[model samples]
Target: MAFSEEFLSELRARADMESVASSYVTLKRRGRILTGLCPFHNEKTPSFTVYPETQSYYCFGCGNGGDVITFIKNIENLDYVEAVRLLAERVGLDVPQDSRYDAGLFERRRRMFEANRLAARYFFKALYSEAGQAGLAYYHERGLSDAIIRKFGLGFAPKGWENLRRYLNGEGFSDRELFEANLIRKSSRSDRESYYDAFSERVMFPILDLRGNVLAFSGRAITPDAQRKYVNTSDTLVYKKGENLFALNLARKSKAGSLILCEGNMDVVALHQAGFDNAVAGLGTALTEQQAALLSRYTSEVLLCYDNDEAGQKAIRRALSILEKTTLHVKVIRMQGGKDPDEIIKTHGPERFRALLQDAANDVEYRIMQARGAYDVSTSDGKTAFLTDACKVLADLQSPVELDVYASRLAEETGVEKAAILAQAGQLRKTVSRKRERDRLRDARAAAAPAQKAIDAVNPERAKRLRAARAEETLLASIMHNPDIFSQIKGEIEPDDFVTAFNARVFAAVGACMQQYGHFSLSMLEGDFTPAESSAVAAILAQIPNLADTLQECRDCIRVMREEKGKVGRGEACSLSDSDFLKLFKP
Candidate 1:
């Protein structure tokens, strides 16, 4: 249903920012604001501030800033409308039904979710029933407890084409919903509806989102002859492979600003059952940027607990690259004997695994270890080669402190002087910096050339004016950052008077916000424009110069232009001639 402005306003009023944020973060009063550890990124000091007066929250550490609806949307991984509906429901408000709302799509998605839920329940029942005796025995042999099985909703899919189909069909679910949910398929020859249970003769793990919704499932096969060891739910309308994490619902509640990232569902369950409740696993695929961003929302640090094999090391490296963009601190847990976290925990006990986590090394140290394993460093030539390759790896470190530390370690390992190592580091940094600068300039030139060419061909005079107007817009942005400037211009100027369309839009948005709320905020306008418009506004703000003195400068320029116009009207000889003016202003 299309929500009214009043409904949204009422929802915002009922959903107090402090109260809602306090549910996830421990807030301490600081004057009129509330200070807490940023739930979006890991930090020792609290940079996440909540302005209760304005009903908004922002993390200065990260760049995430928004109102209550945005908070719920980010924290709960819901879209804007869903966030609004959730908060409205929380406050006992009803959303008005309207024809604009696609009830059918909503119903279809809900039915798919329901189908997955029912399939999970049926699989769980089958795991313990007579039909699941072999699966139960397999779990028993693997040392998994009944409580653990129930905790993870572990289940068994019978080795038949129609087992799940029969159960879901008997429950009155339509074939279309089942097929769309990836729960069934049709036979090629006879057109018989066959249950395409993604999992069969395997132990199933139901993956739950942070909101306790069953989004997908992962299953591990038991038989040696199984074609694939693990089978996961394919992407559906409600479940995206890269967007959901296993057991995040429970892990986000961890008091420590750290989480254990495992390679599989079994690892997560094993850790959780062993009192490490802050364990989560990525989808049966490699860790993605979206998954890393999601992890950033819960904790500040992550311990990678992937397998101790070649592929596992590769995955850890891939994950490190993906996580490098996020604010989450990353460390890799190296398993000594076991191949994976579950096996290590089962063999050496959970305490040993936990102790290993405590001693886990950061990415640089882990990469050094990985390099040492790959190359021999005994002889002088070997040491020289190893250092050369390792320095390249160390250069990828984002923190200068980390780079320095690793450089020193590399010097020690290679018997090279610290000064020499530092020189190499400096050279690498310069090379990388120059490459980045060139790429940036290339992109900027590419973007500007098209617009510039269009302007040059169509209207050079207007283009020059537009560029000047852009300079003015930047000045306005700088002024807007200062509350005193708004007071100065409150009665004297209007945004509609701006010359360029881009500047006019930004000024209009800011002016409307100031009029309505008595103040202007950049975040209030995040969703009000398209991505391109936002980028244009950001570019203008970044390029504008002398913001504090912009008003006087703009007024002076206007006066000069008017004076020159008056001189031309008097038919006086200008700086050049009429032909010169024509050439300069010609479109």
Candidate 2:
């Protein structure tokens, strides 16, 4: 729904920014602002700042800032209208809909949600039916309790090829919609009339968005000798594989401060049921940067508890690399006797698992320990190689205190002198630093003008006339910094007097904001902007800090802009040849 500026402003006024943010983040008041470790990224320090005066939040670490609606849209992955409605509902205010609101996109999303919900119901019903004996026995063998199974909405996709396809189509979904939902696929044959279910003879795990809507599914093969063990829904209108985590809807609500990063859906289920309610997993895939980023928003730290096997260890290494790139503190848990979490909990019980979580190795320590197995340090050559590679890893540590401790540990492990190891690490850091500088220089040298063009991408000749563009930007900023100046100069300058479509649009938006709110705010104008446009507008406004000479500045900008516009008009009318230029210079 499109809301009027007045209504959105009212919603912003009513919604509690701190309370809403605290629902997901643990915030502590700092002076007039409430501060928290940014949920948008991993950080040891509190960089997610909430300004109560404006009722908005900004993360200094991630550069994510906006009002309450923008916060909900980002954190919950909802659309703008959905986010507005969420905040409206939270404050017990009805969302005022504007006639300009187009419900097509929202309608399509709702249809997909309905399809998935009905499909999940059918699958759940089938799981308890006679046809689901194989799936039922498989879960029974895995020792999954009926309560947890049903709670997680575990189900069985039947062995019959068309079971789901026929059922969903009969329930009023078109074949194209079913295909779009990724529930079924058209036949490989020339005749498109025949279609088959995407998953069969597998245990179904419904993947939900934060709002508890079934957006997709992950299916684990129940067939004893199946070629691939698991299959997941491809990207659909409602789901993006890399952007979601299984059980996060429930997990984010946990009072636990940290989350357990497991590998599979069953493992996540096992962890959650074992009194670790903060466990979440990627939907049948390795941890992705998107998922890692999403996790950073909900928890301050992540404990990676992948399986004990080599594959799990490799996954842990890959996940750590990605997670470390974020601001989150990372830890690792290597299962003592089981291949995965489900097995570990089954064999060792919840208490033992909790103990393992408590004693989980810090990521850096775990990396160094893992490095030990990659190289044998008994021989002199092997010792040198181990120290060199180990120091290389240690050099990436951001904290000097951490580097010192790890360097000493590396020296002790390889029987090398601590001084020598530190020296080697220092050299390695220098070498890495030089290489990065070279890479940056190379990129700079090879770079052309930005491929991302504005509405008006100007050539060199056109750029010369963009002197007015700067003037236009300054005029906009002057108005932005002080709104009363806008009315003073309203009759003096026309919108078309602004050169460059980018600036002209910004000027128009400012005019509209003034008319509606009787004032201007950069944040209020964010709705009508693309990220690129927003950045451009912000850059322009930031360049002029003082509005001390608004009247003079505005008059000067208007005068310069008119001169530039006159130049463009004259230049367009008369094209001078090179000979004409040479004749003019001849005395």
Candidate number achieving the greatest lDDT relative to the actual structure: 2
Q: List the residue pairs that clash in candidate 1.
A: 42-300
Q: Where is model 2 more than 4 Å wrong at Cα? A: 15-71, 97-103, 225-227, 398-400, 432-466, 480-482, 516-549, 576-587
* CA displacement after TM-score superposition, residue 149 of candidate 2 (Å): 0.9
lDDT of 2 at 490: 84
Which ten contiguous residues of candidate 1 have the minimum total lDDT? Answer: 450-459
* Candidate 1 ranges beyond 4 A from true positions: 16-81, 91-102, 190-196, 393-414, 432-587
lDDT of 2 by residue, 499-520 (tens): 5666777888888888778765
For candidate 2, the per-residue lDDT at 458 reads 27
Q: Once model 1 is optimally superposed onto the true structure by TM-score, how far is the C-alpha of residue 486 displaced, in angstroms?
A: 17
| TM-score of each prediction | 0.69, 0.83
Q: Please give the distance, in angstroms, between residue 119's alpha carbon in candidate 2 and its true position after superposition.
A: 1.7
Lowest lDDT sum, 10 consecutive residues, model 2, at: 447-456
